[model samples]
Target: MIDGDDVGKRFAVVEHPMQPRALAAPMHRHHREDEYSFVLEGRIGAMLGDTVVIGNPGNLIFKPREQWHTFWNAGDTPARVLEIISPAGFEHYFRELGAELSNGPPDPQRLAALCARYALDMDMSSVPGLIQRFGVRFPGGPSPAPQ
Candidate 1:
């Protein structure tokens, strides 16, 4: 695990452990950072714009800045990944979002403010279709297939 500061703000690494069929986030894009997800276990499915791709263990998936994208655990087992965010700072958004989520279902206004502060653009409406199409489950959404 590495922080942007440790890397002179070039990049930050965060480990994500996902439950079976879990959708990591709504379709979103960053204005200032690119993301690289390296699968460590199980399967990861990602949608970059209109194209969908899957990454298995040892595979890397790149999501460039300003591209609409979202990823999910595509298997009926736990999944793990290392996310590398370039040019730093976006990891703080994750930290803040985690805190907001810890307070139960987040207040929409606050969530929007958080996204705005991080230069993130999210399409909440795309969530349902993503869930349905991939048979994935967003947090607080339908239960995933039995593990």
Candidate 2:
């Protein structure tokens, strides 16, 4: 989580690692905040609304609030993405997830509740097809339950 959220501000940045051939997060959308992702390394493939876009290092992409989106690493190497969320606090969701899973395995019920609190709607139905399309692996395991 970024310091901006700690100060109660309008933006927060999170550095997300997109492991080689892995999904970053379930295809989802947030109704409360806009998000921007700046690619730092490797390749990233994203579904923004109805379109699919792939970005290389130094590429930047926007995910407007309330628009359905999802991303994954599409290359043989690992990837890095700097996610900037506007109108902060949502970053806490990511932080808490790390803490939660560290204690044990993932708890979908807890995650769903937390996402509801942050106005995040998740979708995972596209994972299989995407993995086949990109010829990558879904080492992230089971996708999150839909919101």
Candidate 3:
């Protein structure tokens, strides 16, 4: 179980299998923070601006401040990753948002609202394809109903 829920600047290393989903961090461009991630297994897709990059084991991605980006696991097997935020004190946003959404999957409108609040404008018309490709499931929702 990933106690990523446990808070503090120094994170205790823990890994858990997450059902696939295009998890987006509320859209905030870091001006002084640089985000880095390493793929331990499976495919990880990252969207930055209009560019989408797929990451596999041995792949490393860097998103400099002022560039908008988010990532999601995009494979049958669960993807594992370790993310680092530079200039420090940057994980708080993630911690708080995780707490809010930890209760359950937000309704579509809520999800979109949160995304809009964060500036993550996502098009769910293609979400079905992503679900098919990534094998992602919402936290408490049944397997997506056929579209």
TM-score comparison, 1 vs 2, better candidate: 1
Clashes of 2: 0
Q: State the lDDT of candidate 3 residue by residue for 110-141, as single tens digits.
A: 66565555443445454454445444544443
State each model's C-alpha RMSD to the native.
Answer: 1.6, 4.5, 5.8
Name the best candidate (by TM-score): 1
Clash pairs of candidate 1?
none
**Model 3 worst lDDT run, 10 consecutive residues:** 9-18
Q: Which sections of candidate 2 miss by over 4 Å? A: 6-8, 139-147
Candidates 1 and 2 compared: the better one by lDDT is 1
TM-score of each: 0.96, 0.86, 0.59
Q: Over the stretch 63-131, how does candidate 1's per-residue lDDT look in tens digits? A: 999999999999989999999999999989988999999978889999999999999999999888888
Instruction: Give the whole-model CA lDDT for all candidates, comma-separated.
Output: 0.93, 0.81, 0.58
By TM-score, the candidates rank as: 1, 2, 3
lDDT of 2 by residue, 68-114 (tens): 98888877788999999898878888878788778775788998888
| Candidate 1, backbone clash total | 0
